[model samples]
Target: MSNLFTLSSKLAAQLDQELMGPKVGFTLQQLMELAGFSVAQAVQKEYAIDDLNKNKKVLVIAGPGNNGGDGLVCARHLKLFGYNPVVYYPKRSSRTEFYGQLVKQLDFFNIPILEESDDWLQYLKPEQTICIIDAIFGFSFKSPMREPFGKIVDEVSKIDNTIPVVAVDVPSGWDVDEGPTSETYITPSLLVSLTVPKPCSKHIDTAKTSHYVGGRFIPNHFAEKYGFKTFKYQSTEQVMKL
Candidate 1:
């Protein structure tokens, strides 16, 4: 349960720049590659739990950003690991070329991708066993959730009892530093914090939900700069519960 420590959204960005910035740092290309794979591997343990019946399926709600890209990567791994994962990604705007590549890779794997619609909530079948993967928003998200995302988060909240949601980094619609500003935030059964735990994650109810540190790609130099305690996430294993 002990680890490097928690960081605010601002400090999280600072840590990213220190290790993944321009010169003398890992390129976004390299970072994204490692990031996607690490995330997939991190949550693999949960996907294969013996108690989870094979009747359960995965529902991935992805946004059009790096976070969504990570979800796309995770979906593929979920499929290869023997779980059926269907993605709901509304690709309205082109966030970046890399984003396209992520989608392309998902398609290459023959994963089913759905576009955002008014009744996207229909995908969560009440009669069927399911788990959600919230990849909608990451740390950069600001307050006042927008149209599709706001409604989507609210919808997901409604289904928490039937299906457990596993948020990728920060929970969708949650404040990056403090936590959810309102009850509308989607409460995840499992929250996987990449690299290090963010400040807002401190608010998560560890007694009820599982919180793990993932993204075992950052180098030790960055950890030393922040005086981190070598966390054992980006080192020992692909993912470690904190």
Candidate 2:
């Protein structure tokens, strides 16, 4: 597995652009749906609905970008899988047509969507929350996080040891290729890499972190075009544990 190519931040963005371009013609919604669904599948694989007799309440911390959109979709599927998921979406995307629909689906499912407030921390109870999905940032993220997200990352770091946090793509506040560059960065117990494993993944402490790769939408020719090896996912699986 060490021989597998880990994409740098630039390459990761370029690959995404290529996927969404006319060559592949895949829409952002399509990719987000698959990526989010794959993440939910990874969650089910790691934390079963009845695992260890713990409660099924999951706290999903969503950002305002595409990664957050993935979280929104993930929460919807988690509910369908019978897990009680509550979303903490402080900032939302302005693309109402897309994000609005995702939000509507969550509302239709009767899932709780918590917005930013002075006492937002009250919703994040480690004892009551079985798992926390870190969807606050992705590979496109850079250093020096902004306002509430910076504070949010700090709080999540404090509770990292108490709750099992599953980071979507790159961990929040981490340098896309250099790994953790700040004290506010979160080290999630499990990481679900989308498309390809980012170069920063080399810094992951394999002994402490359970890594999984999802987003099985890359075509074989695309990998050849990019000169990266395609991962071999198990039969009919959307995600594979590494």
Candidate 3:
């Protein structure tokens, strides 16, 4: 796709609302699967490019919303593809049953669910080839810095290693419209913007990082209706670099 649209947080939220509600006819489960699969495709691309250690593990840091659900789903797919993925999901919203379903699926796969109190440093090894999937936040996040999440983002920033991070949508702690508040934000090595990227993606320095647009489930009519700028994701490809 040569042309792409940059969506404000409000517009992104609207699209999600329409799709998840009765009008769009896409359920939380379906959307989660599409997102998870798209992320899996991106991860495979990274693993090949970096020659990451097969024996080394993947860590998925997930938040409390559907963003976290996407991470949970990603972990399951990674495991099925023969990569060990550990989840660090600290919270869950009571309003959505999808979160519970995601948890159950991860449990069925026997993937490890890291407790919030666990020391994350123990999982880090400077020389080891590790990849972190930051699914900690999405379009719904607001900022001023909260408790454990703030601490968690701090921890991620402190990791002084080449362990490439793949952010699912918007990077955690980043503003969808305002971009990053500081350079200390979680700058991922690979960013997979689901369906269409949010406005914050414009802040990403393409010279130093790889950005991609995935999530192939958006219908053409919806794209036209929403005025999404175009891209050409051929049938053989699931993602396109930005």
Candidate 4:
């Protein structure tokens, strides 16, 4: 497979700003909706509902950031697309208006929203889940994961590799540009890089991991402004494998 442009964390943040600013004028809610939908499509494409065995559950471990919101939206869509998804969002963000709306929507779907608990591992076990969505961190995350996430990543590392872990954006505990610095970093089976892949995309083991680019909402003007190399998506698909 070919590669796409690798964006630094700074450039990524600036792109987000431009996308939301007056020129592009996209609301955060709108972007998140599209991103989450794209992610759901990718997941569905790779792990089809008909192919799943007796277990058809997806475990989405969401953080407290916009990535978490994307995960929430993804879980909701996955439910509509015929998969049971359970969300483990321990620390909800202070952006109550937006995140609360996501929660309300999940409630409407009757998806299980799990909080931080001692028994979190019960759901993380390979036999318990068909797939694991790691929506904990993004490119903005720095080294040394804090609080429950550090502990959570440790658990993720120990799970059986038979169950695929699909990381959203960047894998948790990995440096955005430098890639995995620690030995214990979680190795995702598949990575769904939103908008554009980060510089650390090169660090992932291509032979062992599958990477795809989602979030096809980037405007042409901004792409030109950043000198982003044009890449083709198959037909009308929102995501393209890289």
Best by TM-score: 2
Q: How high is the CA lDDT of each candidate model?
A: 0.75, 0.87, 0.79, 0.84
TM-score of structure candidate 3: 0.91
Q: Which candidate leads in lDDT?
A: 2
Expressed as tens digits, the lDDT of each residue in 1-242 for candidate 2 is 46657888888889999899997899999999999999999999998867653554898999999889999999999999888899999987886689989999999999999888735576466667878999998888877798789999999898888888999999998888889987688988999999888877888888878999999998788887777767899898999988
Residues 46-81 of candidate 3: C-alpha lDDT, one tens digit per residue:
775244476777888888878888898999988988
Q: At residue 109, what lDDT does model 2 achieve? A: 99
Q: Indicate the residue-level lDDT of 113 in model 1.
A: 82
- Off by more than 4 A, model 4: 1-4, 51-54
Ranking by lDDT: 2, 4, 3, 1
Candidate 4 lDDT by residue in tens digits, 71-181: 999999999888889899999887669999899899999998888873667777666788888888877787767888888888897872777888888888788888887
TM-score of each: 0.89, 0.95, 0.91, 0.94
The parts of candidate 1 lying over 4 Å away from their true place are 1-4, 49-52, 126-129, 233-236
Check candidate 2 and list the clashing pairs: none
